[model samples]
Target: MATCAAPSESDAPGHPDRSRDDRWAASGAQLRALVDAFRSEPVTPARTLQFEHDVQIVVRELGRQVVPFRYNQVEPAAAVDQPRHARFEHETYTRVHAKTRQNVWTVFGQLVVRRIGDRPSQAGEPMLFPRAHRLGLVHGASPALAARACQLLAAAGANQQQILARLRADHGVGWGVKKWRPVSRAVSDEMGVYRHDAQVDQLRTWLAAAGASTGRHKPVVCVGRDGITLRLRMKRGSLYEVASTSTVRVYDRRGTRLGTVYLAYAPEPGRPAMRGALTAVIRDVLTRWEGPVPRWCDVTDTGDNETGYDDRVLRRMTHPRTGAALAWVRVVDYYHASERVWALANMLFGDNARAVGWAKTMLTWLLLPGGVNRVLHSAAAFRAARTLTRVQKKEYDRAYAYLRNRMSHIDYATYRRVGVPLGSGGTEAACKTVFIQRLKLRGMRWAKDGAQTILNLRVVFLSGIWDVVYGRVLAARPQPIMGGHVAAEPNELEIAA
Candidate 1:
């Protein structure tokens, strides 16, 4: 994970008296020695677990040794000349320290940097450190470390404590909550700056590939949305919040899904941000498609948010270039519709062996052509054959109406025959991956920012654009120091897995 900064000489820690030439020469020799030591080590220690563990520690040590040699070489973003007055919107700031020492965290651990600073003459005004911001430090963590911590935070079954533990064990980096929280929060926020564009670009490529692909049927593009209840950090009398996950997928003609783009919103009223994000990408792809459009379909349960996203956003979208409406085959997820039938079966035959037999028959019928209608008819016939309690009749009618009303959506046989999707597996998988797997772990409660810190990383990783998007973020660091009018842009740093 090398940064793109140009090499420059700086005195090494504990050797500040050394000349610039002496420092560079010593660093070069030290780096070469570390490289030789690395080559002497075994490449693969998998045969012996102990050897593998030993090799990992050795590699980490080599990487640690290399950090200062390169990090100190990153050209400092300090202001030139001794001109002092600085205007920010309205107030004026003055140079406070010609150079100040600060600790910066990195994957190799911490490094002390001497950066110039600025502050308002008024008491209580906080000093600003421009070099850190220009170099894309997330608070105190370097760009690479910030990127690493964010990816680690997305581990499927790991909670906050476990995440920090893994960071220490796997990477030999120490991180405590007070230091880690703000760094990750800043990185997640930085990731948001490039989220929409990166995903849109990803989806465009997928759509183009899917359209050009030759197959038995048109390439299938799936639209999915689902929601879950997340336990929030005990706040002013609210224990739960609703979070939503949405996905867009493209499949080749043979019904093989090529890839998927995922979007998750922690909690917002109507999730307008999420809605606008999806609308932008989906609309862009449909409008600019070079040839035939993929067979677009929506797969979701009849939940309010799921159906609402379809009805309002995805259902009858109009292409910007062409005035014609974009079409989507809205299918109710077969698995969910199956549950509705099973509900009726339970009501029709409570706690009896007959219930299993009836529900199994209905579940199978759901896959046949016009299966939902048969399910309704069969349930009615069963009720007619036996006298039911008052409550039983009420529950039966309720369940029957749910299936009856969504008759148009539960055409699994037709969907199967045509090779359209019958389940919202992508969306369900996303809910688990983005929300349930990490956020809903036992005894976990999250603040809005805390939740977004993890959700932002999860969405980017699951969309398969971590490397692309994060690089763009690190490249777009804030410009100019607090007291200076101009400064060179920091080099782009790319993070790789």
Candidate 2:
């Protein structure tokens, strides 16, 4: 098989780098021969096999020729400890034995990177190929390949095996699931770091802008918060229910969703941590708003878990650095409230013809002017008129408590007039899109870290900030450097495959 070779220092006089040109020309010639052979074969199963084989050969040769050119461009020149005509005496690089590292697979073919450096005991020891670090090239795959693998995983929602198949079929890159998994994890981990840094920068910029504002009137901002349960595999072989929160932001009109953010905890975060995560989401929204700080509205369901969300979470949010309170009016989701009313109606009327009729009338009153007052009056009258059974009384009491507890949040008429949203549908949909669609796939079980990392990528992609976030991620990665002593090679890097 054809293999890539680095450019040698020795060259014949007056020859115009014939070695490099000849390698390129030879690869080209072989590619042409493969094409010819493929075309000459008849349309049989054997012929199809021959064509595939020929294509692989051509790609291998092309990769062999191209890798060297790229490597040489960024490879450091031979080290010069001292020279007679040197301008400075600070030069310290010295030539040493070059060792062959593991081969990395790419779309083209297997790529061999030779590590050039000093002896183990030398001062500047174990010099590496600078281009490799610049490109984030790993022992098993190049950065480009790793990134491509991650993109596929994110976009296709494919498992490791499926991703490997798609890559080989679509891009001509071949690697097993074991190789792809770590690359995916590494890229996702980098993404997590990028997300944190981006949020910090955003907060700083928002603080600066807030400080400069002249306190002009701004439009109201509507935020919807909700949680979705994710099934996670426990280390002890049972399933665990983890709650992930989703937040959605919309402008004054609530017609177009501005953005959505998700906080997914695999092993389940504590209440304080969950609250902090939620606070971060609100902060992100404030940072992205163009106008001055606006009135805030939070629409959420009235489930037991979400009952105190307003007081416990939203009310507690403040500017991390400035300590300014972020106050928002809490609104119970209209649909959730309506569902309770429907249940009350069913309990009161049973299979009577008036059940649906009463439910519709109650729903209309709940949404009309003086709705909560009218609904409360009607409930009181109904309770006084009926000598209910114990079960019936219990249901009625429960329904009354639900409405009374959220009475402040049930003012649909005022909310409608003010253009505030009354539903948490945006948050619910966001939960489905950001987490359920990808992470909750069939037979999928994730480690805590792995799930969180993947969630980071999914959020960035769904929020339409993948490109920006990914660029930042690449920038945030520490540039690989040569170490003083001989670095211990990873098991995968020990052999060229």
**Every candidate's lDDT:** 0.74, 0.62
lDDT of 1 by residue, 1-497 (tens): 21222222233544333443454566566666656665777755543565455455544444554554444434343334324655444556676546666676667565666666768767787765556656667777878888888998866888878888777776656678988888888778888879878887887787778777777778888888888888777647557778888899888777778899888888888888788877887877766666776678999889887788888777668767777787789999988887788889888888688999999999998898889888889998888887878888888888898889999988888787666889999989998888988888887888877888888888998899999999898777655433356444333321110
| Highest-scoring model, TM-score | 1
Residues 1-497, candidate 2: write the lDDT tens digits.
22333322211233335655776788778878877876776678977876787677666556655664445334332333211121112223443544444465665655555544433333654543433455566545676677677777776357667877777764566677667767777778777666644543443343344344443223445556566666666768746565566554544333333444445445464545556665666676565544456567888886555656666767777865456887677888888888878777777777577878887888999989888778778767866877878998898888878898778889998877766777888777877776677777778877767777677677656655566677886665544323333222233122211
User: What ranges in model 2 sit over 4 Å off?
Assistant: 1-68, 77-96, 107-109, 117-131, 197-220, 252-254, 269-273, 284-290, 303-309, 318-325, 351-353, 383-388, 480-497
Candidate with top lDDT is 1
Regions of candidate 1 where Cα sits further than 4 Å from its true position: 1-66, 73-97, 118-130, 170-172, 235-238, 349-355, 481-497
Clashing pairs in model 2?
A: none
| True-vs-predicted CA distance for residue 151, candidate 1, Å | 0.8
The residue-level lDDT of candidate 2 at 410 comes to 94
What lDDT is obtained when candidate 1 is compared to the true structure?
A: 0.74
TM-score of 1: 0.81
Candidate 1 colliding pairs: 233-446
Report how far off residue 61 is in candidate 1 (Å): 5.2
